[model samples]
Target: MALDFQRPDPSSPAAVASAQFTVSRRGYREEEVRDFLRQVSVELARLLERERFLESELKALQARGPVDVAAIDEAAVTELLGAEAARVLTSAREAAQAMRDRAAESAEQIVRDASREATRLLEESTLEASRRRSDVSGEAEQELELAKQQGREMIAEVRAYRERVLTDLARRTEEARRDLERLVHERERLLGAFERARHAATDVVGDLNEFDQSLRGTGVTPPLVPPDAPPPPRASRSSDTPIFDANEYAHELGAAHREERTHEVSANDVVAAEVDPTDLGQVDVSVVSGSPATQTPSTDETSPVEPSLVEHTPVESSQIQESSLASEGSQNTEVLPTSDTPEHIAEVVNIFDRQRKREAPRATPIHDAPEHPVFERVEAQPEHEVVAPVTNRVDEIFARLRTSNTERVAKETIKDLVEPEKPAVHESVFRLRDEVVTPAVESMTRALKRQLSDDENAALTHTRAKRTSLTLAAMFSPVEEHTQRYVESIHETITSVAVDAARSLSDSRRADLRSTVARGEVMEAISDMLSSDLLRPLHERIASAIDAASGDRDALATALRSLFQEWKSQRLSIVIADIAHFTYARGLFLGCDGATSVCWVVDPNGPACADAEDNALAGATTPGEHFPTGHQHPLAHAGCRCLVVPLDK
Candidate 1:
């Protein structure tokens, strides 16, 4: 298949001619041919030498040329040709034989030349074939070397490709494994959170119990404490007890002691005073008289006498003693003591009569005395007569009572002015988009359900009501078809909203803890929260709708079931939150430019904004079209809020 570049050596005509001459002429000798001829000549020369030797042998018995040369024998040849027509015949024959030998030699020379040319051609052809073979072998070796290099390159390429494939496969496998691990870890985290939430409910119960116990221990008697314990003690007593005792006993005792002790102690005290001017003494007087204190005293005891006269002389003392004895005898005659010994007192003439008689005689003298004395006389009034000034106290008390009543009236008037009057708390039905529509839908549903089962012309009544209600639709729209379309639109909108909410919640949740939140507790808490305005709207509307239904209890139960069903389908996201960050981030949708703008907030550490921004974002419905219509998130209200923040590290 490969071409050989060797042609017939590009032979010229002259060379061809030369080669032909060398073959045909047999004596041509131009360089290469000469050398070739020389070799032929040497061969011829050996043939000649052998011919000579053979001729010599022929001379002895004669051969024509050499036997070793394989030449014709001349003599044998002459005899065979005809021994000379005796000489002439022999010469003719010999001539014929010589011609034959010469012709044979020439033929032999031509044959030798032809053989040499053939040999030369063969040698050149052999050389050309050898060179062509060498060239072909070299080419084959080079081709083999190139093939080996190509093979190595192919192997290297295969290895690189294998490595790349392995690297890609490893990357993909690692990515898949990481994704799986992340999912598993997320599920675990959800389970942990769910368990904690369940525990929180129980923890709340425990907290309530602990709080109750703490309150019970704080001074309020616990149920465990006994009831018959002693009462706590107190501090002051009545002041009148001591004052009344002193008034009852001291006055009587002091008065009785005054008369008995006056004479003896006064006399001794006077003697003591005279002997020692600085002496201060109290005289004790005992009252022995039997007469009552209310009885009149004798005139003799009332008369004033000079104490200096009694202390001056015995005669004066004797006169004073006589006067005192007579007066005492008269006093004893009027008021006797229970102890009637002479040591106590003695009977005497009527000194009281004598003093009375003397007082009548000194009446003019007494009347002649000075109008004003050195000492002022103090007259004590009776206790009964002293109370006369307080006679109008009852009237004053009545006046005070009237004044207090007027003041109380004035206080009430002032209170009325100061304190705002509270409007009477009454149940009112507030009509709002959710409020009115929610109840109406509930009512319609209940009515429809009732009509579906009842046979009291219920369906006919409902149809009539429906028609009448539709008639009222004229207030908003004139066309009945338009009203129907609107209603259908509302239904579709609400339904779509509900379905989306359900799907979002269901897809996000990784766990549930329903068993931990008992129905009783949930209901109790919900009931309490219903009092707040945040929940009041929904709670009141629901309650009212239920109450107004044809089959109230059943309707309420059905409604509750619907609500719960919706919640369950959404994984209780209305109450339970998952993917809380995404849900909270939805608020950012508010105030967004619907025309062209989109927000690009940082979720670097998950979606947690500051409290102020978050608050500003709460319940800001993203226009009518953007609001999540039937969502039941517990934090959907104006005040309630929460969010999630992923911890990347």
Candidate 2:
């Protein structure tokens, strides 16, 4: 009986060594065949060990749960098994003839069974790994996307908050500018009203002087002219009256009248110096001329004196004589009426007459001058001369004039009248420098510092948000090295599954095949699984995540930079605006160094450093004109290094 050679376990070296093959002319030596079998058995044992591991893994997978049918169909298993069995049988037929043929057939059956089992196991393993890979990739993608979304939201929120701060700063700056304008307008109105009041007061004084001159011309006290004095030549009163020609009067009045006129002119000069020319009316020379009492009267009672003179005639002659006598007795009395009005002279005269009459009764009235009628008619004077009004109560008028004279003299003593308030304004500039400008600059500095601090915090927050997102994305994304390591592990699992399945199928079919050839086949199967299905989709998913993560990181960096720049610019603007508002409100001009780098627009138009130096040396009276927009004030724009200076007119 031919020794029925059962299918020897490929893992057993002893079975291969003891087995007897049918000897034929084509068969090889038993020793050489045994040696080949020994080599095959050794390789088979290695493959079996791998198969056992794969089987155990497959059992573990099956124990966990049911696998999808679509992943492992019987037809696919049969095809894979048949292909592997054919390759193994071909190798067996080439190695040993009939002894190997039987072994090949038995081994072919076993290889087919093993290949089918391995295919099932490999498919199950592949499906489980694919599902796990899908779950991991989905979770990583979701986490990375969530992190990116959170980063975007944080950046947007920071930008919105910065915009709000900038808007509020601009609004506050506008309000400050408006308030400054109102204060300047109010100051101007006050100054104008004060000037108007001053002018009005000056006009009142001039009116009083004119009225006093009119009273003096009433001739309440007559000049003590000797009767023998020849009548003065009839001079053209036209030139004499208007000019108050002391030379014309000297010829008629002798030395005493000239001396009196000189004294009156001196007093008028002193008063005139105190007031502006615009406040005074046309220069009336009649103010300096004495009344007819100081003049040599013409013999004809009806002959008209200058109408300008006659209109100033006194109502009471007796009262004048009495006061003149009383004044002469006490001291060297002035012949000109000192009283501003005719009525005051009359009151003084009445009191003097009572005293004189009581002292010695004038048996014959002291004078020979008759009482001139209040309405005594006089011949008309030249048409060019202005007519003075005929008055019935000259005493009452003179009384009021005396009161005005006293008041007018009193007003001229004030030293500061009509003086410009430049000194006060300069002092106010100093006060503003100390109180407003200094504090404003300090406040602006502090505010900028605070803004810088806030900007830093905002930038830090933005950086942190971006960095955290990036870190999370890197952690969760399959693109990162750690995620790559996880994918590599999955690839290894799939590769191992494929290799084990290929090896198991090969080992079952041909124990005589060389270890290198079997390994090559197993490797080819693993390579196919990696290139075609197992690792390709995973690599693509990781590649896409890497591309997205890279884009998001770049975008976040750009956004953070833009936000920081915007915040910095806005903060600088607020500081500059605050400084400008404070300086302008204090009636100062904002000045710049005129350097090109400070601000191109402001530098060209701004005051030079020398100009500011000159202003500081010379006292300032007025504020400078408003500058054009963009160059309107100190620190008008960001990075401005200008100064606030008092405007020197």
In model 2, which range of ten residues has the least summed lDDT? Answer: 343-352
- Which whole-number lDDT from 0 to 100 does residue 294 have in model 1? 29
- Tens-place lDDT per residue, model 1, 511-564, is 221222221133233323322321233334444544565444444434433432
Q: What is the lDDT of residue 560 in candidate 2?
A: 35
Q: Which one wins on TM-score?
A: 2
Clashes of each: 16, 15
Per-candidate TM equals 0.19, 0.20
Error of 1 at 61 (Å): 25
lDDT of 2 by residue, 1-649 (tens): 1223463544343454455545544343445445555656565555556557656866886799986778867665555345555454444434334445656665565567667778989988975665455435544655677699999999999999999999999999999998677657655654554455444444433333444445546544433222223544654423211323335434444444556668978977786686565422222111112233543323442232232221222324454456446646745444443344332211111211224433533233222232321222122222256889977698888989999998887787564376433211233333333343344445444544454344333333343454354432332333344333323333333233223322322333233333333343433432443343322443454345445557464444334333334434444445334333323322222122121211111123334554333322333323333333323334333334343342321
Name the lDDT of candidate 2.
0.42
